[model samples]
Target: MYNDKVMKSALESMMFVWGEPLKVKDAAEVLDADKKVVKDLFLDLQREYAMMGRGIRIREVDGAFQFVTHAENEIFIEKLCTPVKVKKLSQAALEVLAIIAYRQPVTKGEIDSIRGIKSERVIDGLMSKDLVDVAGRSEGVGRPLLYKTTGEFLKKFGFASIKDLPDITEFDDIEEYDEETPHEQLSINFEGDADSEDK
Candidate 1:
């Protein structure tokens, strides 16, 4: 009873509705058709799209499938898409981000040691920006709060996961151009303009 044309139409409908990814089995179940039939339909559609000079194509990642623009046409697609400018994070914020990226699920105290200063304000700012989140509590003394990057961070940085972060074996390799420091090192600027205004 599974009409191939009807099944292909149903798969397209599912893709439009999902807007994320549609696995072959999931799409088949939604359309009440055989998985193999859905797979064949998908392959046919993919070939047809390529032949017809479509801007988009279907891709499978892990076990999930989704529609994406052709890599070769990305520049043209981007021009058509809305341009989003990301705000440049401050040095303190970037330091905090780097620490969380490398030593994830780390506590504020640990971050303070790595950067040699208190990071409560910077951490709060990152949290407010939705770049980081409370991962969990450490199983150490006082059970301090631990922080980790969120999916928003990955999306902003164009990473699918934190595992995609570049490796940093030596601390010296990290950027050392914080303006608040005397020699552009990682020294804390507790008496900066903001603190001076408060006094």
Candidate 2:
């Protein structure tokens, strides 16, 4: 049985330092406690918060655990935490990125048709920011390049995996758009560019 002091310390460390989601096994190893014991402690803490109607609570999402503000206290939490500045995304770029993220393994031509705009610059920006990458080439004529999201994209957006993306129940739901939006697309070249190649 973990002591109250130990459990409180562990929970504080998890909330402060380990800002990202952590697994029970990982937390156990860090706290030097059995996994089951840590889980029990977590459950107790969660229940206590629920009974008290606390503003913060520990949550399990996709098997990873993290501390999050209670739904009712979101506005208060936002006021306490530093406000996150979001970069604006143009309608054209947003449309292009939406199509690419949802219909990955798609080609530039297909993206252009969907958005009715030349996607070269948009794709270039995404590649420059390392958000998107050439997954492969299409089998069709000209062998157009295929694109997909990168690990950096997931990290920047605080997603454990692509599958962790929020459900798109309704296309018109703006609340679903709270997740990361494309700021500046990064470009990455797997093959050495001309400058590196010259060296």
Best candidate (score: lDDT): 1
Candidate 2 residue spans exceeding 4 A from truth: 1-12, 23-52, 59-63, 77-85, 124-145, 150-199
> Model 2: clashing residue pairs?
125-185, 127-186, 127-187, 128-186, 128-187, 129-185, 129-186, 129-187, 130-186
Cα-based lDDT for every prediction: 0.67, 0.63
Question: What is the TM-score of each predicted model, taking all chains together?
Answer: 0.55, 0.49
Over the stretch 38-144, how does candidate 2's per-residue lDDT look in tens digits? 77777777677778877666655444556666665655655876976645445565566666766778899998876667899988887887778999999999998
Worst 10 residues of 2 by lDDT: 190-199
Clashes of 2: 9
Model 1 misplaced stretches (Cα beyond 4 Å): 1-85, 172-199
TM-score (C-alpha) between model 2 and the true structure:
0.49
Model 1 agreement with the true structure over 51-84: per-residue lDDT tens digits: 8877766544333455656656655655876965
